[model samples]
Target: MHDATEATTTPKSDDELKELVSLARLVAYARENARDLNAEFSAYCLDLAFGALIQDLDRSGVSLSHESGQDSSLFGTRH
Candidate 1:
């Protein structure tokens, strides 16, 4: 959930890296909590995360269709 337009003067500093590490730890904690939930709920969360990632890519003008060549359809007409 990072804003694309927000400009940063410098690259990730030591504190920023530390914050990223902390966020990773939190994600790990969430995974552990998910394991305690039902299988359906865990799968739902995984799917939701994937959908969010796809939406973000779309927002950034990343086309996932076969026409873009990055994702090729099995029966798509080739140029």
Candidate 2:
């Protein structure tokens, strides 16, 4: 999990790119498979927005940590 306050202004690493790709794939899958038009459109818009953010982050070289701490309680257990 990323702690926004702990983020640094550094270039995104290969690991970070991989993580973002994974997230994008999940979002894309939802957008492509959703039956409801509203849900599909919402996911499509979200994907577009997220893509823009990624581009901006790449240009700005922002480093966002993808570490998962002992804070699974926020959204229940991962599994």
TM-score: which candidate is best? 2
User: Clashing pairs in model 2?
Assistant: 1-67, 10-61
Relative to the true structure, candidate 2 reaches a TM of 0.43
TM-score of 1: 0.40
lDDT of 2 by residue, 1-79 (tens): 8565444445567787667555644544554445345676677686675455445444545433223331122213321
Best by lDDT: 2
- The alpha-carbon lDDT assigned to residue 37 of candidate 1 equals 68
Give the TM-score of each candidate.
0.40, 0.43
* Candidate 1, superposed: residue stretches over 4 Å from native: 5-10, 42-79
